[model samples]
Target: MTNELIQAQFGPRAMDYVRSSVYARGESLGALLARLQRDPIRLALDIATGGGHTALVLSPLAKRVVASDITGPMLRVARDWLAENGAENGLFCQHDAGLMPFPEGTFDVVTCRLAPHHFADVGAFLHSCVRVVRRGGCVAVIDNVTPPEPLAVRFINAFERLRDRSHNFEHSLPDWEAFFSTAGLRIEHRQQFRTPIDFGAYCDRMSVPERTRTRLRVMLLQAPAAARAALNPREVDGRMTFDLGELLIVGRRAAR
Candidate 1:
């Protein structure tokens, strides 16, 4: 049921994600690229490759990249986008992140960017990533994160769910650390950054109706002082904008 809902929500907006400035360019992407460049990657697996942006970025760094997504429509869009961009080393596959259809230790590097908050089972997904990545290889994750404060976490997650039904919940930094440990991956590097979201574009990308958008706007505006302060909503030239906290975590699979 969750997978069906996610596919339905994202299938039509595949191109929007491909062209989205937030996904196409970001410090997190740059950081991931730099980290990958430090070592040569024989083959990389990009799970939940929404628009093939991360695979495109990894194409030059890795000899081969498998861009996998669960949704057929999304995978098709990614394939088309990758072909159009001349990213020849990328291969598209329809696969679930939590249950990848690849042999263990098949990839030298694994990545999932800007997509895990929607994952139904992030721990299982990480375990699959660990299973597929060779020992001493890298697993990079870039996703929006919630604050440690219980109220702040609740508010941000509520806001996300209200805006997009596909959203699960944003995990905190500590949660990610624990997940990596449980997956037998050692966290080598971590960084936190903010991504500015244009409120209008955010709504339009999801094709949110005007009534729901209005309600969301009111909710944001009426949020408690603590929540509002954590969100840091701002209006510039009559356009609403806010920052979403994001995290980049690079871990290494431990050798036997």
Candidate 2:
């Protein structure tokens, strides 16, 4: 989707993300935090900082944190969240992740969480992350991923795109690793997690229409055996639910 379309898609639901337990306190967020704590951070940038949760996590560790997103409404909400949390050093900027305005080697570390699948060009995004971080610095990422099986890949991406129009494509672990390598980032840490998503709430977050919801449910229930295995869809307390595959990886640039 174009940047404008993505902005329009998420602008109205900015607060939903801020209040989302999955975004605010999910295990993936915690894993990113733990990995970051092992390194020293003076200045950090959180790209696509959708509710600014990652930026909030970095504020205490870094002297300054810049939270950026393509969506203005999201930045505003994130700013409020940081301010409410006493993050005096937090700053917000509006920009596309693929075209960051920061100068080369300006930040000690850069992070993007749960947002890359919406990026039109993941490679370009990683290039920006590498360019803005100093040599020896790190670029950490966390996003839902799809399995390598072709049918499973198509099924998962289709499912997500139906749920959120802004969703572009979710890369597999191998795709992400290859992208990191091409961007001159050396993989330092890699871990996976299965995040349970409440089907109803997930659909509501994006305002999926009832008609579309039925389609999604049908896709889940009648998915190919491979897709079903990858998604692990199940009923929880009479509510449909499924596991989202997440990959968290930290790639460090070679020291000069």
The CA lDDT of each predicted structure is 0.90, 0.94
Off by over 4 Å in 1: none
Global fold similarity of model 1 (TM-score): 0.97
Q: Candidate 2 vs. truth: CA RMSD?
A: 0.8
TM-score of each: 0.97, 0.98
Best-performing candidate as measured by lDDT: 2
Tens-place lDDT per residue, model 2, 162-191, is 888889999899999999999999999999
RMSD of each: 1.2, 0.8
Instruction: Report the backbone clash tally of model 2.
Output: 0
Flag clash pairs in model 1: none
